[model samples]
Target: MITEPARGSTVTQTIDNDTADMSDVEAGAFADYVPSSELQKVLTEAVSLLGGSERPGQVAMAAAVEQSLRSDGKLAVQAGTGTGKSLGYLLPALLYCLHEDARVVISTATLALQNQIITKDAPLAVEAVKNVTDSELRVEVLKGWQNYVCLHKLNGGYEGSEDDLFSTMEDSLAPGAGGGGEAASGRGTKTARQMRGFAAETKKLYEWARETTTGDRDEAPRGISARAWRQVSLSSLECVGEKCPFRSECFQVSARDKAAQAQVVVTNHAMIGLEAAGKQNPLPPCEAIIVDEAHELDERVRSQASTEFSANMLATCAKAAGNLGVSGSEELSQQAIMLGVALQNLEDSRLTQMPEAVAECRTLALPPLKAALTELSAKSGSDAGSDGEKHADAAKTAVAKAALTSLLDTLETMTPESVANGETILWLSRGRDGDQEPRLYTAPLDVAGKLANRLWSEHAIIATSATLKLGGTFAPLIHKMGLQLEEPQPETLDVGSPFRHDRQGILYLARDLPAPTRGEHPEVFWDRLVELVEASGGGALGLFSSRKMAERAGEVLRERTDLSIMVQGEDSMAALVNDMREDTSACLMGTLSLWQGVDLPGNTCRLVLIDRIPFPVPSDPVIEARCAAVKRAGGSDFMEVSLTHAALLLAQGTGRLLRSAADRGVVAVLDSRLATARYGGFLRASLPPLWPTEDAQVVLDALRRLHQKVS
Candidate 1:
């Protein structure tokens, strides 16, 4: 068994080739590996399909993938913008899988990437690879159950008084912008089919999906609601596996089984976190795991492993338990009632606060659960009970006891001193799914520790992503994932970018601009923004860190110019993309959703506007705890980690400027920190090598010149 190294002991290798030691690695170990000319042809085809030219970064990514497969040692490659990093990695991964017959799992940060891979990129790459590889490589996309619509929940409807609640939801969703029953566009154009019974539609599609060759969600002609998807979904902890009535034909199970049989599997970070934590074993063990948009891995892991208890969930569980036969008996049933009432009383009292409620819930909950378990155990062992009766009694007792004990233990471990001074939380809540039950719970700020301990320790794991590096190095990132660097120096390489950032784009910082106050409107910034947009001639993307900010900016732009302004939350992401693509002189103002994963080459997005540096909220429980934890551990959490995390995200944000060698644009960041702060240099270094300037006119002129060239 391999033991994890002591914290802060691992060192990351410098990007330069000046000091790397070649003694440990064989010089020609990968000499037999040659870049497939056929794979190169496919990449060329992809570039042509997008009407863009390939850059150096894309070429290097392709090379790195080819080499990493042969060596099998861990490899991290940073491919800057226009690298076609997705296709770069895809080409080699496909070629190698075909040759070695090894399964490969490709994981990404967002649903957008997963969609692209399953719907667009994967198919395109496969079509190109098929011409040369002489073998068909099977690929599939697997997501958490909650992402799919549930046939049972949709058809059966909800159990309680959800009829009225669901009726309101249905009515609200019925009419779109154009007075149509379907989700309509501004012009009254409906984007999809009319609403149907969620369970029936979900199950029908799921059944049809089984018979179809590709199980991609994009195959569905109409869009589905996120809320509707949650009804039929099951997470790792909630899944009962083979015992499920739909086990033989389960969509999730079939997806996993197919992944095991296929050569390549496309999945997301949350599922990967579960896989890394050994929570659910879906895909077969593979030689490598490729993580796309890798920067979000830490946060994604935290989200999946963390537990959330609402006042509602607790109340529902209490009510559900009461309805169960456990409370049908005389004495134990009375104890169960007392237990539920006490829990509810606590929830109603000073326990409205999450921390206090978590503490009190543990105290009130354990004793009753223990008493009920004792009673149930006694009944199960009685001579008067039949075999089936005994089994049922025992099963109920075991589940209640196990769940109560686990929750109690978790709450007890989450002390204010531990959480407030660290990066974890023990949250208490008061709400359930369309019911009035409340629950109490605790969760961790980071799931890397759990994941590393449970899965990576015993497995030869491969985690890959495009935007993993934040501050020129991977040190800040690996720490969040609960993995330390190996030896005094860990391997590092920048295969170099295919796109010429210095030539294709410029980075403009809005220095001397006043910081935004809480109540301020866009009027203060709109004058300068209009001038910039006019200079760019409307081919721009304004990215705001907040949705409120994005909407305000959109309002101002709408009032100021003839340019088309499409803001997020105004419509679906698909609608926004379509609008941006149709009009060359259009501006798309959006929040974090458009920060990364947006791909538009040439004139469509010639100017990128960053409203602010995306920073984790100071009052956020997880971020606050993590910062304090770093401080307690004898480190400066702000400068050492948090800022670095922000820088990486900023890099990802700025990278949206250029997607091909011929793609030219100016990335304008409203935050002065990219120019003024002492740490500004650090953030700038993380971005592509763009020519930095503070002159607004210069940036405007550049945008004009670029737009003219494209037009």
Candidate 2:
């Protein structure tokens, strides 16, 4: 572990927060205006209100965060489950924003946590602050523009010709419509069924927009299904900001206004990545940042930095031509047809499969498409004055122009060699459900350098997550985040889990089981799973390595056992979890996603079955390339990257077992490698300190006892 430079003065260690000795905070306390005692007072009151006694770990985290933000230094905190990490970070962040009259941004990895912070934690903290300091603290949540309702799209979409929008093009060179079927163009068939479904969904969205207090797509009755939502929402490429009649009530603008006025802004990781990458956005600038799920930061940044161009874009260009009714419409339409056909044919020749071919397509088709777009642009210009009750024809033309120009700009950047480079991940993916050509994609091989340059260097960042350190060291994360091991290094602390893991959890490795060969779950494994579930009496969460394994096990379990088996995709995620919680005898099985962000306390999940070690697919181009780079740098990619990744996942999967003090369970790793393989000890260190056992009967008996006690 790399130690930070010594502060001029030491943090006075003392007993504070009434019940706990916050040694972690006092270890390197902030030398700022607010005293540690004062900070602790506010945090203690907030914790009491949020329904927990004072936790030493939480207090220490709050102090470390306060020090980093006020001093403009970076800090990495690993606050384990039951540490009350959210309130610890938020209370201090809110107070700092209020004191300095500056905005502080809090970023999470998902919408669920973003909403939770704004709706649940933020409000409580605001009230807590008011109670303690008699001051007001305001918070607002911000998402990307596309997440909001676009009144322009709502009013202008389908205005030109509903029939034309879904018509099958007659051009033989174009990639014909797939109509959402299993065909060459999966979404080629844009027929009545497709059109009607879109119309119905849009109508509902339109009605909701008028009445909704918050025009967030995630809040709609029907969640934002990409295909359905795209019909009514506008990407930045399609939006004519502040130009339409609905400008005053524009959801995006209003959301931005609210965020600007806020002292503390709650947002997702994507927004942070975008801002760091130098993309202009509506989110407020911050004095300090608190990244809650910081472990995923580098990956999220890489994903955001990635840009792709697909053939479905040709449809947008073609629609723009039809909508404008311009003089060059015929020429633009022909170019669109030619480009789509060329892209699809190139893909068929395995252009993306081989790196060399992806580079060549740039020479063959890119220049011609750009020339056609320039000619089309010269033929038509925006009509600013446009209004209508039935159809916004003039506005449609302006939008079409914007969409076409954007497409042209995107394709212009992908050079043949640049598209197929060691630093880029290139692939071929089919376009959306419609008459669309497959898209050629190139994303960054890794985000470490970009994030290190863009985010960590500029802001006083507070990176916090339960699983930031694999095997209890922040070295991997620090390196990946582009931080150094030398002086001025980020301060670090690992406030361990508050739960009594030694008593509350049991670690059972099924050593008798065979090795997982070629990532396949054997029939014997399924039989053992059945036996375990039967013994546990169905408070089991069967987490598998693949969807096929989950589905197969689910089917066999349903046939072999009488317990209600709920599998993912069988119903909505929320619905399935709710159903499982409502019934104690229900066993829910799913893939990788279930490993984290699950909160099934008490008897909802008394046993967790890990079918195999969670490792990245060896064939994934990105992973392979990342490993190659590590090896070239004189590092063991398997240990640093692969082992670390699997360990973090195992830690996350096991963390689900002991969610609360009252919760107790068995984390059974069915693969024998975790017990027999050389890497088993390293992996075991990632999990909680549970009572280890190898006897199958011992685990079965314990499960039976737990089930009996719960019942």
Candidate 3:
């Protein structure tokens, strides 16, 4: 694995060499080859059929993608919103798959984008390519095993320990005296009610499983809990492979088979992360990878690689072992109690060093846990019995083995050697309520090494996102992704947005407002915010740094203005965005999620209000450790970790203003730091090059005029 350079280090590489002036002999080589004419024709046709006109930026991106794929080099393209980025990459990918007879995997950050590509964009690209090459392309969606319903579990072939636990409780409560007694008052009544709900949900899932051919949980009835889904689905670890009687009809197996036959496979980042971690290869082999929303790849990979342990998890493992008839199960339960007690004695914070309590728990629990896992692993699926009985036994043993293996892994991660070497960072966290039990979490200090050795080294990569470049360069994100260590360093391109940013929008920095402090913003900030919203006639999207600020802004605005005000937590984000789109004069206030993927065009959104710079909390475990690492490496942690994060989010929040060529609005930043800080220029360069001004009146006048025209 390639070790990453120090954070904020300047690692530069030249752009892809222009082939226009090269001789035919030199350019004919794969490295210097230009995009084929066929690529342009297919892309043009795809755009035309999608009801869009030609975009220079999209064409440029497509050409770069084609060159990268043909030469087997890494490329990072920042195709701004409305530049038709999806089609730009999809067209080249489809063409490559058809002509080369090779496969390509397209990984996205969200399921919504996956669905959009599979249902809408992929079909259009296929049709466009078919029209040109007279050949067809096949696309498939591949997800984790847990996403599909396991016929073995749904068909009553596997009764897990959870069912046994519930049964024990019901039997224990069965001896209650006549109806309407103490049994109907408190705990008993609540248990009965919960049991009914669980049964109802499980029954519904069974019915749906019979009717739905795909067996995907995403297609199941809405409002199903994760607990209910677990009853019918199997994790990768819980699958019994060929031992299951339902293997012939398993949805997950069928999906994998389909992916093997597909020319293009669409999956999420988590699946890629799992593969990169050497956990499992859920996807088939592919020649190239296209990571859309590539900015989110690092964090998603980190989340998948991270693991947590709690008393409840230990209890679950103990129950599974007990159900599997393993020895030492009782000792495991005792160790769980001891561990819970030790956790309660410690506070919730990042552990700079290993705690004695944790070490003691590990030393005591390791033996029993290992012994149970050994016995469970020794159990065989091939026993002298009926096929039905053997199938059920195999499934139950798989679940027990998986649970014990996960518990053992968590214990191994807590070793002092792992924590002391700086390979991992450990922390303790809990639920929102104080009474909730604390859980221990351990994550890799850096995922760059893993990603370098596993992903970039193995495939030709084309990573694209609107916000990949930070502080006017792609070096920061590239270095973070470990792409800088690749043999032929990735080429970077910025196909600017199709929208005329300077003509259609204004970046309003509130220079006169007081510098924001820790707690609440000054009343003057609220006053200025109201002024901007009123100027835009209430067509405003407020992106705050925290939920408290967003909710407070919503409350104050509803009282101060006559227009409609919708808070994010008031309803579902989809419903809230739809309402904001339908009601022209309504103002929507939200944090984090609203910064990206909230697309409202034309009159529905005339202004955007940013409360302050969205910076990562310094006390966060991962952020804190990363900053210390940079500091130790003689680098500026603020620049490498904090400022870059803020810039990306600020850019995303700013981009929410313009969704189309016709969009016209003002992005109003209430914080004065953007104009006063020394790093202000760098942050400004990260954003769209809008017509900028420090005066609030200039923005107000522009908004009022735009609002008047729309009205």
Candidate 4:
């Protein structure tokens, strides 16, 4: 650890010192030693490869490798952009893996980062390690099933043909229909004509891909479509695992097998969450895990755990159940009645205000659920027909049982404990359109305590992100993770970016603007947004806090600008980004999805406009309970919990700007609170250190200069 000269600071530490020709440090204690001159040479090579100068993040990571290895304790590093963080952690983990002959799992926040590591950084880092020493180490990328195309689905074709579905699917798969099959020009720019011309070529290539067995899409980035990917992707509910006929040829399994043999495994956040949640534990217990772009983990976990019931899902399940034609059909119908009865009881207008009936249903729900599971178990075991037919019947019955059981369990969990400090609320919501079936939503009062207990209790963990520490401390966020220690010894480090933020970037706010009511000032907001986009000559990304707002704002802007506008729901996220990149003057208006994973550098994106700070939905059961819990604990929920979450998201949203040192952009926050509220300082502190400006002309001038340079 090197210390800079300041008012009263004096420190003695080695920056880069070669300790020895070859040495072995304890797997957990590697961070204790200063990098010898020999190690410095290795660091220099990595830095050069990544096109970054040595910075605090790099230095801290080198040190953390030693500390995280030696103590086997957790470390939270806040490495900003342009810090070469990917290499900062990767290089150290690589060295530790080689020395200890142990495997390392590196989890990142996005597929883009995972792909970059597998395709670019890991290969180069492997070579860098080899240059430093002749040690041989293997590295591989691991992703979920959806990342690869299902050859069976593409070639063997699916069952049923209601809407010329097979023909439509085939045509889409055919090189250029843009129907949602894989594309050769994964760049997402191929027009319909070009796609058609290339369909045959893509089919031939896909056939070859099936035989190769790597099945990892990162190996071939462009051939898979969003639709095809959905069919192949596996969630906890859908993965038949060993039961799938394709088990032997399973791409997910094959990827895990490769990872099992490799010293370093590159993967994404959700997969890591799955492992941490004890869902996907495929690889050998890793000795160390490096998290790149660690800031996005919480949101990723929330999304992965979120469950929404819809009419489509209900109707599909019902039809699939109905398709079982059997003598026991009446009994099956009765079992379905249990679900309907429970929902109907809650909906009865006469019982709607009755507290006792609602309480009784909540109380008796668990027993019926258990009985249903037992009955369903017996039915599944009884053979209905041929082996395949029986299997299908059993699967359908089991799915129904599981869904019902989950509903009951969720409800049970949502009930507040007597004498509990906080309240738990239940919400019933109907699907879109008047006729869609209604659904129930149940959420726990708080997830932080549960998250911390699950992640930190039994395992040696490291949680790193660009904005983990807000207001110069991490207590609030750490508490949310359920870390409870008087003095949690988790190592904390910040790698501030090397970007010329003070000179190249500015933060603009509509402070004088009135707060936006739910339905008011939308037009005014859109008008201001259009003016900013025009002044910047397009090349902007508009981030809305909600999907409704994003769509509404997008609609308003579309009529006002000649620049192409791509909204989130209109197309796949990948397609939108690809389009945004291709059109220099295009404006991509999207909800929170564009906030973090997006990466557009240089003049391709010079302005980022945000509609508001993304606060969690107020009606959200989990968030509401968490806030209430904080209040019950005699703390301000807004300051302790809600604000912390918002600050982290705000940091992520603003992070879209200035991706690299050479990148320059204006980050415009339409939310005036960012410029007016007292807690605004906390949010501002969380952002990348940038010059603050309220003058619109100054921002316009900077955009003009950037536009001129690009032109």
Candidate 5:
């Protein structure tokens, strides 16, 4: 174990003992080793340039990351908030790329984090590396094809189709036009106003698309909605590839080209997951992968690996086949109807085995789908010959072929034999309304095996996050990631936060409050919540487990007091957070996303109110299936699946307080479970070591004092 030194102190510990054993290996095995002094010097210069002070945890983390990259080993780091984790990993990644002349891929979970690394962190690291090594290093951002505007779609290529952006805008401008549906006979004024807004935003996007060189959606005007962007962009399956006249100047291709030429490539977790699923290798080959928000990797990979089948999906495939002049298009459409009927008859639950009716529909549909795909593939390959019509036909055929190929792959995965084999989990999910259709979904029961085979075996991995180790240890996450089975098992490190949690914050456990029931909290819970907000004079962040509870709390607080209250769905998250930051007396209430996504520093956020322990709903199909698997293996499902989920979220929620060294606050858990339940100790260990108190008045007094100080 490596112990991090005190704040502003230099780290003296070497790499872990296991790494020391491999220090004398052959030349080519670990060739890109950079001395620890060089890493520290680069980090020091980067910190100086960024106008930040030195922290021992950041120095320790940088050394650990460097050791992992140098030994070609795996590591998981838990660097708490205020540790400067981005620079900790970036400096080493940049140094490795400079020394070895090999590419390194850095993946993050969110677009905000990806943009932060590229725009803020990477450039400073590059400069630091250049200052030390006297060599320029290149870095590029690579995203999915849909993230950029499609030239073919932006032009008049799909002019007559439902995908045409200009046609959609024109329709929106028509009187009584309801966007997708036909004009309502007497549409209300509100509907008309909304359509006009959509039209205006779409027009702005169109004008911006014409002038932007990169075509990246992130660079476009801010007001555009996702629905408008879809009209101008293309999904991977919708792209015509080399058959299009705009192939050479394609933005997605250009981004990939730049990434290929760079030494460090920044991408997202979903892209890495897609490559692991054998869908497509969207990333450049790299010597190592540093997953920065590492806690979200497993769930993100499962999302990418999951497949869904719906009537609308099949109907769209049929329409694409019809566009390509495939003969069996009608048959495929009929099968889609049959599949929808079969799914309607079934309840929404995880399947122990595939139903006969569903299996029959899938089996009957495969042949015609395959035939249509074959014909489309042939047409897609035929020469366009210098004629404009022929070229358009070729491009359309290519896109249709890709769509059919994707449909075929989904159908094969849903085959009865595949479902019965115990390798996949199949379930049926319905939309929120009764009128909406139910869809069949399948995902790998476990992604550990896939990640181990496809990712860990190929590259050195450093997975770092603020919440990687739940319940006081890394074993759970390590086992979940399948790193326990690796040849050279991953090393673990916990470079503690720079903030003095005990001195800066309090963990207030409401021991007298009743254990929360399933639906609504008791009246007493609301009373206590109001009291806390009043005590703090309202710089509070309310973290709820459900939207209903969050909204109800907002209503109660808004009625009970005069402070400004903001709910999650009332406005954009960015707007809500900004409002909270600007007005120190405002309260922002939201659900799961607010737990880890927000970073509100200073006196603006002085209280974090947690409604209860955030446990996964037992009725969720994936949770049910995973719990069953764990129980069958003779393990406690509560500890493995349920408790860990709650613990991780609890840690993340607790972290919302004390964002900086000077910040002070109280993380008040309104539920008594964290103080009286059997698992309380485990959950408490996962959080920052704050001063704990059970007396409500003690916390109220502390909050009042902090409020007075800030006021």
Candidate 6:
């Protein structure tokens, strides 16, 4: 095979390669699905139609899900990469919703996964079910109401900053622009060229929203920023549902209505947590719940259940009340300013305890605002007018009411008793820039009890992910997730991956390098990494420990090598991934999100470089508090929390190497801790059974041979 170096990226490979072969895998002990059963036939047909091979691990996971539905059993299963886990659980979900007369809800981690299930997997699964059962299936995808475009907010129905609403996307996204982090201080902004570019881009969004079937942000065309999208989007606080003039054409309402009739509803983890935590009930009732990408469930739940109090939100509240023509708004506005001042002072001082100024603001400043909002909410749109006018007025009032209610909830979380009881943690979380006003945050330190009450009690529950077991066991995840807090605990199963990891992948630990230290210079890391990427001919996905490391590596590589190099946040994530796929020699370097969801199978990705172990920040309040609590309860804080978290992330990072059974690659861990530390054994056990090697020459030789074959 003839290979060439990338023009600037120094990547040494050509773009052409063969498509990955994904065939059916051998069945294991999980073959006990009722033969000739409606569920079985539909699943069989769906696999056949997917134009891929069946995997035993997939079948095993599906059987677990189906059985849980058949009985009332709860299940926790781990299906590794290339196991076709999505279809494994989805086919049964569809069969149950259609054949067994059950309602099923599938919640995932990211919006992309939600769409993939609803748009790609669900359609194929439905067709397969139709073929076998001769039944029409109803599947709907639902996100939070805020995820949809609010007709009122888009058309200047709100009372605040509509004239300059999107004057500068930079201002809107600036530290304090919309009143969240810092007051929109108009500090540093962009060029006239950039603003013109933004104007054209946002105009495209307006046109697309009118013509597009789904007004969801994911459906938007390329180059549209979040700041631009938020102009057309709605939050619960800003929406007046059922009162807007364009309710008939509302994307959010339509989606919810469709979900009401759907037998199967696909959503993400955050929406499910909100539905359970809040009384509003965003979704219809479901008899069965299936959570995919179950690894991130804890973090999503924490975020959904938490709320932050900031000056910007307070400013919005005051404006919403004044729009109702409230008489007391003059005093309320003054109090809102005081509240903002108190917040700024509290954050600036960096004190842990609640200050007197903040307490007074909450007591004296907040009550009048609440009263004004309530009065307006109670009599909103009462002035006699045409139906259209009244509807718009009511929508505005709804927006005010939503904000008022949310503020009260935020207040409750920050109250002394709530913070003292240990059920919730109230702390001041600073911004990326220390000078920004610190927002008061209230988050659940643990959601176990809440899940026990609202989640574990479901009729049937199935949780599956590529990396669920913390360290060779499901006990940690199950216990922490509150999956076993109720009667009839879930049955645990491990459906191993179909890929021959032992032969197809290598775990190359760079023992010659020194351990990664926070303050130490990383010249050694760059030297080893650049050499490895050159040897592999540029099919590498580099996962770094921090943004600084990623930047240094990216800069050094781009300056020294001729390979195509892409860094995170430099462009939209979608564009970077597309460029990498098109330019095979390109090396995509980033942290976090890229670890798991990225899929560049076969020759396009043959090398993965992990800068270091992904341990939680030592200063993170939440993780530190949890670890302390575990230590107090007679558990090893390092083992139960720190090591466990790092192990799961390492498994996820390493799993990126061999995405298909036919794919062969190497995962190089630049950190020497995996070889020197004692707990390394546990982490290694949690990963796939990749062949181990320490010699750089061995890996370089293997990469060359694989690169030749692909060429």
The estimated TM-scores of all candidates read 0.74, 0.85, 0.89, 0.75, 0.91, 0.89
For model 4, state the Cα shift of residue 509 in Å: 3.1
User: What is the C-alpha lDDT profile of model 6 across 1-711, one tens digit per residue?
Assistant: 112222222121111123332333456456564433666677789888987656667777777788888787789999888787888887888877766677888999977788888789889988998888788789898888767777666676664534221222233433544442333333323345677887898898888877777777777887887767766776665566556777798888889889989989998888778865754667788898888988888878888888777655666666666777764556656766876677665543223356677676666655676677668766764767987677667666666677667776777667655555555666675566664455777777778777778877865888889888876888888877789797777898888877666557777878888998886447877888888888887888989878887887788889879998888889888888888888778899999878878888767889999999998885676776677668878999888888888988898889888777667788999988887788877888788877676767777777776767756
RMSD of each: 10.6, 7.3, 8.1, 9.8, 7.3, 5.8
Top candidate on TM-score is: 5
Q: Model 2, 1-711: lDDT tens per residue?
A: 112222221111100011232222332332332336667778778877867676667777788788888888888888888887888788888878878887888999977678788789889889888888899889998899878877766765435433222222334324542233466444455455677777777777778876777678888875445666765666564455544677798888888899899998888889878875666667777788888988878788777766655444555555556555544445545555655565666542212234443334434445544554565455434444444522354345445655656555545545555444556666665543434446666566657677667667777888899888876678887777766532399888777767656556677788888899876677888889999999889989988888888898899899999999989889888888889999989999999889888789877988899998998876565677778778988999999889888998898898888777677778889989998889888888777777677767767777887777778
Q: For candidate 5, lDDT tens digit of each residue in 1-711?
A: 112233322111111011212111122322242338888789889988988776777777788888889889999999888888999998988888778777899999998889998999889999998998898899899998889998988996755455211112323323334544333533555667888998998999999999999999999998789878976887766677776789899998999999999999999999988877888767988999999898888889889888877766666677777766887779878987888788878998889799898888778778888998778777767775665776677656655666667778888876677677666789987754434467788988788888888999889999999888888999888887777778878988887777667667778889899999897999999999999999999999999999999999999999999999999999989889999999999999999999986989988898999999999999887788889889989999999999998998999899999787777889999989999998998999899877677778767877887777778
The RMSD (Cα, Å) of candidate 5 is 7.3
Worst 10 residues of 5 by lDDT: 11-20
lDDT at 519 for candidate 2?
60
Give the Cα error of residue 408 in candidate 2, in Å.
4.3
Error of 3 at 30 (Å): 19
Better of 2 and 3 by TM-score: 3
Q: What's the C-alpha lDDT at position 222 in model 2?
A: 53
Q: Which stretch of 10 consecutive residues in model 1 shows the poorest summed lDDT?
A: 9-18
Q: Give candidate 5's TM-score.
A: 0.91
- What is the Cα-based lDDT of residue 691 in candidate 3? 68
Question: Looking at candidate 6, what is the lDDT of residue 167?
Answer: 24
lDDT of 4 by residue, 273-365 (tens): 665444544545687766666556655655554443222333333333344332333333444445444555454111112245334444544
Model 1 Cα RMSD, Å?
10.6
* lDDT (tens digit, per residue) of candidate 1 on 1-711: 112222222111111112322121232333443456766776776677767665545655576677766666455666565445778788788887888777778888877778778778788778777765556788887776655433323333222313211122223322232364444453332223333456566666555544544333545435554444444443333333333344565566677777778888888888877765445456567766776776687777777666544333333334434544454224333433554454565532212134553445545655654554455455435544764444344334434443443343444555556555444564333432323343344456556667566654543344455555666776776666655633223234464554445556677788857665455534546677777888888988988878878888888888888888888988888888888888888889988878778887767888888877777777555566667667877999887667886787788778887775566678888777667778777777788776666777767766676556556
Off by over 4 Å in 5: 1-35, 161-194, 384-386
lDDT for model 5 comes to 0.82
